[model samples]
Target: MKFTTALITALFSVGALAAPSITKRQDTVTYKIHDFTERKYNGVNISTLFFNIESPPNSGGNIKFECAPFVFPTGKTSSTFEAGHVYFCYKDSPYSFSFVPGDAQKGTWAKLNLWQTDSKTKTYVGDVEFREPPCRAAGPGKDTVCEAQEDYQIHMSVAGSPTEK
Candidate 1:
């Protein structure tokens, strides 16, 4: 009976030791507005603009926008935005962001065109493509440095009054 109890205690200790850490590594990336316009298309307010990027801690040392275009349709008109805010967060490493439309625009989204640079020569680091959707939920045990997936969330709002249109 004592031997059985000892074995059980040992097993419990091992299980406890094998548990993953609960603490998370968090960082924020900010993109500032370079330009924006408020216009009325039909009767709806449409705002589009470009933004400059500020580098995050682990973002290949510097920040620069890649030349990938995004296409979207608003009601009867199709609009293309050359630039806007691109916010990204990573747990272990490797992250991607794809745009998702709000309640007003359904089935409309954009994918970010991203690339890593040489850090010195300011050249491309091989070829890195953005593949994941923005603000998607992440799973457990995914917050590792060697893993190629990370979780992210987004918070956004219109800057002007509704009556301005």
Candidate 2:
């Protein structure tokens, strides 16, 4: 029968070009804490939000998202505050993160890098709209105040595995 219908349409076009369309994207990341040091961090302080994502020939892997929970007041800090919804890649390269009030876990994880709003799309996906470096307290007894929590900014949606390079 025409070689079994052309070998079942060339095996469904090589299984849709070698499969790799796994996806899951959610957004709502906003964490802002500015403690000019009076030394408080006592009333409410819990943190963990690291999200560094790079999508090149690395193609996306099995990743998931959604993490939220924060309330650090008493020392005071807020440029905004929603902080949550960040998933990570499975095999590697996609440090998605989230934390707050977590048992025995208290503040420190402000890594940033997940930017690529639109470079044209080959599809690995990364995007950050938060910029830092206005001269963050560097002198004078410094230690300033921006008490980690992955230092804030993450909300992307990109999947991987289409014969990843």
Candidate 3:
């Protein structure tokens, strides 16, 4: 009996350590976009809001987005948008984004697909991707190579609506 109990406890402890931590934020929370390395991005206007590279000094802080209920263009009502989705408001207008895997050509950079947020039916605006600088060897004659490590990751900040403040 003692052996069995000890084994079960050990297994549970290992599982807990292996599992990734998850955070549940309110729907009205405000968040900022960043690369996996936690490098902040500036909102460069391409067609919609684009965060390609890290924010430069004196360029202000990171651009923020909201996770709030959106009002349909029909003005019928406001409802919570889809899960795993974020809404970015630019120039008093809201836009949505989706993540897509890169092709063989663009090895590490992932595609960020944009959507026009007005009506319930989303309009396919376009897509933008963040390309990292080419990876080089860390030091003299080493097998290890320091490659670009940007991925589809987001960091949330304070609580607020999708309005850019």
The best candidate in terms of TM-score? 3
Kindly list the per-residue Cα lDDT of model 3 for residues 26-127, writing each as its tens digit: 332222234321111121111112333222335343433332223456442123223224544323344455543333474666555444443343232444
Q: Let me know the TM-score candidate 3 reaches against the reference structure.
A: 0.26
Instruction: Give the per-residue lDDT digits (tens) of candidate 1, residues 38-93.
Output: 22222222222222233444544233332212332223222332233332212221
Model 2 poorest 10 in a row by lDDT: 31-40
Q: Rank the candidates by lDDT, best first.
A: 3, 2, 1
**Clash number for model 2?**
16
Note the Cα lDDT for every prediction shown. 0.28, 0.32, 0.37
Across 1-165, the per-residue lDDT of candidate 2 in tens digits comes to: 999999999999765534333344333222222211211122223222222222222334422222222233423332233344343322222233332212223334323333222224433333333322122343345322333323333444443533222
Identify the superior model by lDDT, candidate 1 or candidate 2. Answer: 2
Top candidate on lDDT is 3
**What CA RMSD would candidate 1 show?**
19.1
